[model samples]
Target: MTKKNLLLTILATSVIAVFAIIALMPFFFLFISSFKAGSEMIRNGLQFKFDFQNYNLANYALIKTERDGIYLKWYLNSIIIMIIQVGAGLFFSSLVGYGLAKYKFRGRNIIFILVLMVMMVPVEILILPLYKEINSFKMIDTYAGVVLPFIVPATGIFFFRQFCSGLPTEIMESGRIDGCSEFGIFFKLMMPIMLPAYGAMTILLAMGSWNSMVWPMIVLRTSEMQTLPIGLQSLLTPYGNNYDLLLSGAVMSVIPIMIIFLLNQKTFIAGMSAGSVKG
Candidate 1:
């Protein structure tokens, strides 16, 4: 490569590195602050200065012994809900998307348009009606209530539709010629080819479900049923805040998302690139 191109590449890399560091700064502050006592943290606030005297494992230890380890219960609840949301989201959303992408049927364009319209409408606008529906079904404070409304996300459907549109339809025709059922073709043939899409969607769906607060808070009435975000927010009240458990728990809550992103990092980029260009 020419020196001009090389210089440009270096400059671009430097800029990206700076932005990445800026993005990570909050998590860095949260990690270090979790080691300090509540009073010290409030007094000192988030700072670059590292004082060994102010730091301890007390916050983390409190997570284990405090309130009979209710923090762990919250963590488990979030995990279960995330799992259900991601699995169901992928299954139903992809089915709808694949049908729209590959099938020639009436009202297909109208259905896709409807999906886009729903995507444009913010979730906040639907919350009231969703809550009422959940209440009517007597699913309040249950996992179903938390996971049902958003199981087939409009965004997921749009994404999968775009990706599947670029796929060759010959394979699908071949499956039919082999006497495979429609479900068999989708599950066995198309699904394997859609792995990159699945990987990308898995991370997206997991993050959405894990970080969800408002919906779960509305649906769950009991403390034991609360997800991590709700549980952490509960630490803050009009009287005082429990920074001790709050900071440490928040830091730990980030672990699962980081692990998921790392695992799917390769497929994520590919899937995103292909989807962007395809449709």
Candidate 2:
């Protein structure tokens, strides 16, 4: 390669590496801190220096014994919520997006415009009404209350719609010629072709659901039903802090999202970029 091109490549790589490290620094700190005692953390604060002598698996072990292993319950709850939200989100959001993109019907543009408008509104602003609505339906303190309200997120709909718009409709027509039902065409034919989009959305939806704290916090009343984030935050009280449990639990909470992203990293870039371009 030319020296100029090589130099540019090196510069870009160096910049990206720096940014990646910057992003990962917090996680690294959290991982290391998890091994420390609560007193040590409070005394020392977060430090760059790793004293191997102070590190131990005690904090992790405490997770199993603390409050009769309540941490595990929180983890399980988060997993359940994440799966439901991601699965239902993708299914319903993609179907709506697909219909909006592929079908020429009355008020289609208006509906798509409304989706865009919803995307602009912050969830915080709608929380009051959402809570009231969920409460009215007697879904409060239930998983349904948390998951149902956002099962088909506007962001997901917008993403899937944009991606579907870029796809060719020829395959859809061919499916009709072969006497395939509309759902069959979408599920059997178009779905496979949209694998990249699915992969990308899967990671995005998983992360959002996994990390969600506010809506779940409001909906879930019982301690056992509380999600990972809420459970982790409960460690910090005005009386004292349980950094031993909190730090370790925080580290564990990140695992699911990291796994999802790693599994879908290959298609994430392609899916995100492809959705922006029109066919």
lDDT (Cα, tens digit) per residue for candidate 1, span 1-279:
699999999999999999999999999988988888766667766777988786889899978887899999999999999888999999999999999998989999999999999999988898999999999999999999999999789999999999899787877888999999998989988887888888999998999999999999999999999999999999865333377899899999999888988998887676334422233
lDDT of 2: 0.87
Could you give candidate 2's per-residue lDDT for residues 68-157 as a string of tens digits? 999999999899888999999999888999999999999999999999998998889989899999999999988889999898889989
- lDDT (C-alpha, whole model) for all candidates: 0.89, 0.87
Q: Estimate each model's TM-score.
A: 0.90, 0.91
Off by over 4 Å in 2: 238-241, 267-279
User: What 10-residue stretch in candidate 2 is worst by lDDT?
Assistant: 270-279
